[model samples]
Target: MGACDRNCGLLSGAIIGAVLAILGGALIPIGDFLINKTIRKEAAIENGTIAYENWVVPGSPVFRQFFFYHVQNPSEVMNGSRPNLKQIGPYTYRMRYLPKENITQHSDYTVSYFLPNIARFEPDMSVGSENDTFTCINLAVVAAPAMYKSGLVQIFINTLIKSSNSLMLQNRTVKEILWGYVDPFLKKIPFPMERTIGAFYPYNGTTDGLYRVFNGIDDISKTALISSYKNKSTLSLWDGYCDIVNGTDGASFPPFVKKNHVLQFFSSDICRSIFGVFKEERIVKDIPVYRFVVPPAAFASPLVNPDNICFCTEKVLSRNCTSAGALDISACKEGKPVYVTLPHFLFASKDITENIEGLYPDMNEHETFLDVEPTTGFTIHFAKKLQVNLLVTPSSRIETLSKIRQPYLFPVLWLNETAIIGEDKAEMFRSKVSTPIKMLHLLEAVLIIVGAVMFLGFMVSYFICRSKKLK
Candidate 1:
């Protein structure tokens, strides 16, 4: 009877162990499948979803910091000398995206909205006041000759400059330079044109464009990705693939972002789509994030990065090409000879940087980058840095520009639009997303380890008992 009881006990132990092992092994894959499905479902851009709430209105505070290049020797520059520059500011502003307008949801799992960018000056966050005055290029005088190619129009523009007593340089307050100011020369022109000019005159109180984005109901991977801009899938500004409007609106990205993923986004400010490549993994607010940076290849010369050939203008193509790191966006900026580059000409050609003084390019300060949590594709921290330059050439037709012997890309100002997840938002993410996922992972590990150990122990004991009985 005792032998019988012992045998029954062993049998019961074996059965329990086998059941645990089978259940745990099966759950390994099943648990993973469920977790992925839940994440995908939550990631969808629907009402009450985290993605939707974040997209409609971002929780992070975005700060737009402007750094102006004060040309110290405007007269010397006019006489063919390389312009000595002084970097002034971090005249900072708090950027706010007003609630989305014209929101329309489509049957094909997409939604459209118009987002307006609004900025308010923040004195405490700034290095200087907006009323601070600086000596800068008279953009109106410099841009006129380039805009009017016809000799007849050039003559008229030259007449206007002479009549208005407009010089190649002028002193203007930072507020007037960044917001809007009625250019004395521009106001006098007979032709209908934009008289009020500023670095961000058009941007303030303006909607970027109509953005139609994927809702991710059909495919979670495509969430928040822009399908079209202003009702077009491609822009009229550039040629071929460069015209294609790809990626999200820089507010949010799709879930399950991979390390090797090339994260693309349409920048209304630059009037083009840009992409970021994974640089490294970083920890932000105790959350692991993948750092993606705009590579130098994005602005490389056509020779080095053939994809950039489409961005080249007839003038640039005529010269074979401009050097790496300067993108001539003249077409996008209403025929203005505007070139966009990384702040302080970071990664730009020596030809461009050497012609200007007082530019110190530091990767930490100037590089454009985004830190995203890979699991949810939530951007924890990001800095979008860009420098605006004017292609200044010695125009013989325009008297004011005639004395300048050499043509150069003159740095005007740069901006750093940056944001990071707030502590409140970070805590919520940790509690709701990170902690839950971690707990599941721990449970899975515990189940696998305990079940395997119990099963193996039962097997060894059963074999030993059986061998002893047989002996």
Candidate 2:
């Protein structure tokens, strides 16, 4: 009876200890794997750092600078010329975000600013590109510049843009303001804005006319290159960093990153343009930042449309797309006159910038960079820099455009939207990241090993005592 009772206790002890030991053994790698997996997917799904909406109260002016290529040698500049680039005002603009409900949501919960009241603050409504250029535009022919200087032109242009019961468009959209209100002049531009939105250009960032407004960058509804937003939507230009997913292994990457990881994306080219690979990892203020550089070859790549980015084909007149350091994404806007460049011409080739006297390009101030936390896959610090350049090619027939030179892409404005996780936020995130590794994992693992050994020792003692009792 005593032997049987002792065996029963040993059996019970062994079963309990074995179960606990198995769980403890799994407390480290298994726990670590699960935690990392969960956090990475959460980030890919909803990056906490991403906010698609912002409100601007009437206050400080948004600064914008313009650089124009001067006709250093008139004969050379007639068709296409090197930029004797002149720098202009850091012109300030004031605008407010449209009301929430007033904003257009293309699909899902995507909503963006509507009719952003953009008013440029000219000291006295004076038209100034800073320097006098005889080749760019003849002020005598384009009275619009004169009118703007007098402050009456904006009011006048505003009236033409305002919604009137008598006007054809009730409340004119941004697209309408740019190209849609045409009568006879812009008839030959094939289809504009999007093919998916039918022939006519839809409303601001809208797709099928049914969905008039959509969030461009944070639109997480889709996974394709367009990031699942409305295809060919101009808003996609704002965000080129799509979600990071390893196609081969069905895993999410934290941007601590793998060497072979490449940023493969599709653009207005309507094809996949492999942007580049992660070149290096940097530590800024103890935070990790991953830097991606655009290979000069990207500008020359077949994926980029030379005809769409800029129209100069002549050897002497080329927009020098390769060296200019700007991505001609005009195709994304359906060739309706748009170009994207790094802020303040930071990445432009020195060969091209040497000709420009007043312009200064610095990587420290203008380089495009992304800061992501390796553990949480969170983009804590980020700056997506881009400048929108407008081609000011004028045909001899248009009265206002007759005087402007042929094939000049003008820098209208550039913007850098930045966000950073402050020290407090960073510390909080660190706690979250370390908790699973230190608390539950370490404790449970130690308990498993210790409990298993102690239980086995107890069982051995029980058997030894039982044998002694029988003796």
Off by over 4 Å in 2: 1-28, 40-227, 231-256, 264-276, 283-289, 293-297, 300-324, 331-336, 344-356, 392-406, 422-425, 434-471
Candidate 2 structure quality by residue, lDDT tens digits, 1-471 = 577787778767877777778778777677767765554444332224212211212111233322332333444433444434444333322222233234344445343332332333344422342222333322112222222333454344334323221211022222222223532211322346221221123434332211122222343222112223233233434233222211110011232344455543332222223353566777644555565544444444223534224222223224343445555444455444445666556656554344334456676666544554445434455444455554445434333343455444454335443445557645555565545445776778777987698679768867887788789
- What does candidate 2 score in Cα RMSD to the true structure? 13.2
Residue runs of model 1 more than 4 Å from their true location after superposition: 1-27, 314-318, 449-471
| Top model number, TM-score | 1
Question: What is the lDDT for 176 in model 1?
Answer: 94
TM-score per candidate, chains pooled: 0.91, 0.45
lDDT of residue 194 for candidate 2? 21
lDDT of all the models against the reference?
A: 0.85, 0.41
Give the C-alpha lDDT of model 1.
0.85
Model 2 lDDT, full chain set? 0.41
For 166-207, candidate 1 gives per-residue lDDT tens digits of 988889999998987999999888879789998888667788
Candidate 2, residue 378: how far the Cα is off, in Å: 2.1
Residue-level error in angstroms, candidate 2, position 78 = 11
